[model samples]
Target: MGAFGVALILGLNALVGYDLLHQREETLARAREDSAAMALVLEQHATDSLSGVAKILAGVVEVLAVRADAWERGDADVFALLRRQATLSPLIRAILVVSADGKLIHDTQTLEPAGIDLSDRDYLMAHRDRLVPGGANAVFVGNPVRGRTSNTWFISMSRRLEAPDGRFAGVLVAVMEPMAFRSFYQTLPLSGDAVVTLYHADGPVIARFPDHDSHIGLSAHHLPLFTTLLKQARAGTELLDSAGDGPRRILSYRASAEMPLAVTVSSSRDAVLVPWWSKAMTLAVADLAGTLVLAAMTLALLCEAGRRERAMADLQDSERALRDSQQRLIQDIAARHRIEAELIAAKQVSDAANRAKTQFLANMSHELRTPLNAVIGFAEALESGIFGQMSAKQTEYVGDIRKSGQHLLSLINDILDTTKIESGKYVLHQEDLPVDDLIGECLRQMGPLAVEKGVTLTAALPGSLPILHADARAVRQILLNLLSNAVKFTPPGGRIVVEADRVARSLRLRVSDTGIGIPAIELDQVMEPFHQVDNSHTRRYAGTGLGLPLVKSLVELQDGRFVLSSVLGRGTTATVLFPPSRLRNRSEPLRALKRAQPAPV
Candidate 1:
């Protein structure tokens, strides 16, 4: 019977796992189909958008062909025709008329110089050097480029302007802003991590939703997604790492029917599987509960059968032995009952404590924030001299009051955050975030603090680093707290360094300070909430002692590790390590910034 029970349980477990797996696959398949549909829609929209510009360009070409003499005479009506075309198309940034020799004759935006040369432009060069066979009205879509006149990224579309004698006259070009395409993408019902990108066949990204200005004209040659699309058929779907932020995603792309541009739409695996995982977990828990109940029933039946067998043996032998067996069985049963009762009581107590803790934290958060907010607001008003200021002493007093209020507000906010984390009310909004950007911003914000404290600060970030899949706000807070503490403790002439390096399958960020170092014995205690090394009411530093504890909580929430090491008289180094699972390679290029050296206080 026991063997049969074990076999049944194993079979059920396998069946449940297989069903969940199947459901998850089905969900992913649906997401892929959705992404493909979205890609097709985007492609059509892009075609229509470009086709509209092409029509406007075609109109200008015909007008110029019919009125070549008017153009030569600098006819206001001809220039007005060009301006009208640009006005009709809001997406068109500018319209330029370049002579056959590549010299600009007229610009819809300005008429400063008729001799300005645009021969160096790709669209001009393409139109001047080569002609499409048997297609005189063909529109050439140039690569995404920055125009010297506008100094903004645009997609240039040009049509060959012809003379009445059928010879080429000049190139009539219309520059379209990438933001026009981005606006269309924003209207799509895409997940937060879902990305919609429009890129040229060769490499440059024309427009992308969730865009970075720097990536508008950046090269995407290193991306497998683009390279694979270039090799494969015009339209297809595949699982690939996102070329923008390195999350694994299901990407569907379709090349434009008219242009050399491709529209790619991607949905992140995490977003697609979120609802499926929730349902799967629920079913899994239910299955586990049922399995436990079955096992318990099986054990009870087995025990009863053993008890009956013992009774039969005792009855056939002696009464005394039967009585002894009965007493031992009773005692064992009573002990088991007592242990079960204790377990039930302990569980009840734990549940009650948890509820109480959650309630207390919530109440304290609301109550404290309300009054602290008022205090800070009033103090700010006084410091700003909204109420007329009197003497120097009065101004100084107001400044002190404002500073104290601000400090108190900060402490209150930290306490609320820590309480939320401890009570399990804190949630992380995880996404692909550029750690380098966050690091740079943190250093900038902490710069003034570091200088005021007479501490030299430096940062050495790699030219390239993997983007972190984490809560950006939490990660920023962690860095700010660490850097703030470093600045606070380090004395005059002391140096603080913030650097990041890749280790094995993880990334490590270290913040080291030449501060009054912590004692080795208090290292573990320092991470405890509200437990400072100098646990005195009149401590030199102003803090609530929740910085390290809060940092540790935030790091662990993202499945990362935080470690602190210090010597008695030396400095402290705080290291935050993120596992490989939490680190993703970035698809987009980053602007190179120089490594910072220690700045004198």
Candidate 2:
């Protein structure tokens, strides 16, 4: 992190360290005292055993001297050598002697090194006239000097015996390795890192224990403890500080009681520091985790509270809008009722006007028909030459007068039909009539005019045709009018066909003629009252133009329909379609006419 964070962490660790320091005392001195005491106990035991070894070697010399005599007597020395080697005594293992005269003496263990010279050896030279520690007679044990070489590291003591004339004699000696003393000192209770170092006051070491074996002839680590011992030469109790391959160790050390040496007690730092850091980090992580969880829970609660407040405001707005809409709907219903009443009154007035129109048409038709009858009758008789023979010019003028009268008659009839439709008085008396006979009658009436013009007027009636159901008078009038118009317009030597047949559902009545045909634009107009193809053509064809209109009205009255098809100067067909009910009614047998007129002619 940052420098401040580093400093704070160190501060906290120091606080923990300071707390532990106050709880336990620092015991460098007490450790030194205990370790030194234990080392002294082992050293005392080693010194005692060294004294005993000197005494045993003194006896070893006597046994060797006795075994030599046994050899001189030619007796076995084996039993005496066995007694000396049999016991693994804490002091001595073998005993022998060497002479200052440079010759080896025999003993129980001397058979292998016989006749060897010893006067020049260190055992003989160093103790030529000294008294030995074995009560003034100890000899070096296991020493090669004096003809014995078994002692690995030890000193020997010997004394010279003078002749009666005070002459110098050979040395007597003792040998010891000091290994027993070293093993005892190393096994005493001490810290695992402790070291017991033994060195000569001079440069080279005489011997050492604590087999930190590499330090046998070297100085210990150059630590505070070692520096104090070297600089001040103070050998009292003190704390040791050292670093090594094992661990950073704390030590307590003091000089040994009677040896030029020191004993150190040390403990590794791992034994104290590891658990302290573990506890500190455990507490730190637990606190951080608890704080984060609480923060997240608080954020969730605030978000939920905000959502509820917004919902309540929206609900209030919707409730106010609903009440306003209900008030507007009530006012709309009241306005609608008033408009409906006005429409009812207006409908009644329109209906009365239409009835008046029907009445006026019926009355005027009668009036016009009566006067036309007089005019047409008078003009016809005159044209007949009934008032005496007249000039050709007069006959022609009278013919025109008669045609105009008949035309006016046709106009009045159409007006009467329209009035019936307006008044809704049109009725049908449907009955059966033979379709084939019906065509025959229509052709019979129109045949003479066709024959006079030399047009081939004929009926194409199919024998298998059905009876037709319609008002007999109305159906007859429709066909008669169509046939008459066909014959009147057709050119001389042309043809006319009155065809009656059943085609699909309707009974087809087609009146076709080779006539002065209608032009496409004028075809629809001819069906309207007073509308003709053209004025010049109208005067030439001799019709009031109401004939087709009257036929259409009568055909529709029987629930039939009329259609006219024409091509200019070619021909025309007038077809009436009477639906199936009419055809079936015709097939029924008919009784004698209740009311009959002369057959249509």
Candidate 3:
């Protein structure tokens, strides 16, 4: 067939979808009626099971009430008749008749309801309003305890009986086996693959037909069909449509007059879709086969046409390749221009860094002059008594002024030292020094500040550690900056532990603290110049944050690597590892000592 004819047939095929859903809905509706009628039939059996027991058992109660009344009125002949009535029935576990005068007049099955307050019995009390015709039809079945009427707790029914004048005389109460009522569920026809659910009208599953016990006594918790049926005021079947991926189930129900329960039957969407789907699939396969045949014939013509077309395309492609080669040469020239632009950008960055370095040096010079002037001026004032008589506060404040000046001077020197290191103009003063003593010296400078903060300062340098091929002054400065910050951040009672050991050709000095540690993300930023973590509040702690950055640069100057590792809120550990002096000749220790150190007091 041509294209239009095939499309027409396909459109006709699409029209079958409605008939399919209609046939499906109708077929499902028929199935529902059969099932519903079956439900109705089963419902009658259930009613028969309940009502039949009511009639036969009610007759037993009627007979017992008559003889028990005779016994209460002192008629011995009628008492013998009641004995026959009670002992004759086997399903009746027990029988008792209580009189209006609060006396248990008769009993059978070895137990007698005598000398007990029958007036207090639920049967007697419930029957007191029996002047109304037909009395209340609601019945209660309970298990009463054996032997005592007041201590009663066994499964039995209490039904109100009437006198011939419709007077409330007594009650007809029957004690039946607990299993008798449960037999209704057992005798119903439940498909082995299907489930039969008996639930409380309030929607708790009371029982299930088959095992697995899935629904038994469960709060019908939010089953969609169960909820929907409650909203609707009738009994009907719903086949959940699944073509749009909604619920794919079939449900039907019967509301229980016994309780608020609705019994629902659910079937898989696949089960219902099976018949029509097969029919549609057969048509689909025919259409696909026809389509494949058309495609094959069309493909044969297309391939023949493409063969001639490819020859022309090959000739054109050869000509285009030559033109493209020439075009690529011009594009390469443009790419070279981009590379040159990138170089210019890099040169600008280098120039900016150079200008920053110059500004930093000017700042350091100014920083150095202020501290030197203070120390000189404060010492001169103290020696000459320029501020008149000196009290403790006067002497103390001057000492602080001088001390502050020196500390600023020391920081300024570290900045200058880092500048030299970066310029490749810095020299290492390698020495045959006791690495343990150098480590001890660093700890001694840091201990008082640590003690002031209540931080424990300790060291674990091996006594026989090898000498390092490092500038001892640079090492000390680096350790000072690291330990100062460690103790500064460490809260009161925290510990700062300095540990070192020679590993093969390298000596590793590690300064660790129990402090509010560096954030892992921010640790890399700490080595950048002028960086501080929360500098606004750190005014309480001395030193610009340049200390660690300076230490990093100094360590790198001697071909040593400095690494920092920290767990946030716990502590930081800064480690410096350098090659040992044993690896360098004595003559290699060049003169490079510009930073001044205050003598150990």
Q: Which candidate is the best by TM-score?
A: 1
Which tens-of-lDDT digit does each residue in 399-433 have in candidate 1? 78877876776777788888888777898887777
Q: Give candidate 1 regions above 4 Å deviation.
A: 68-75, 111-115, 131-134, 303-601
Q: Model 3 over residues 1-601: C-alpha lDDT tens digits?
A: 3575456546656665566667777766766665566555554544454454456557756564555344454343344455555455444555565565557655554333455565765456656755323555445433222336434223345565556676655655566442342354566554333444544445555445553144444566466545676578546666664331236656566775652345555445565557667766854564454454445434534566565455445546655775897799899999999999999999999999997886688567666777598676876589457878788787787778776776777767766776666666667777555566666677777777777778888887564665465677777888888887887788899988888876544678899888887777888898987777764434466666788888888887776779999888788899987754333433444243332332341
lDDT of 2 at 408: 78
The lDDT leader among the candidates is 1
Quote each prediction's TM-score. 0.49, 0.36, 0.38
* lDDT tens digits, residue span 1-601, model 2: 2354345445655665565554323343344466556545544554455446545545544554444342231123432343344243443333334455745443334344366567666555545544233433534322211124552444343333333364443433333334544575566655554555433222222234555344434444455555565346434444434554245544444443333334444454444334544544543453343333333333434566565455445546655765787789887987788778778878887888777777987999988899899999999999998889989999999989997888678668767866776567877676667666666666676666667778897777665777666777777778878877887888788888878776555688898888888888887788887677775664666555778888888887786779989987889989888766566543457642232332433
Residue 309's lDDT in candidate 1: 55
Clashing pairs in 1: 243-587
lDDT of 1 at 374: 85
Stretches > 4 Å off in candidate 3: 1-356, 359-377, 380-389, 535-542, 580-601
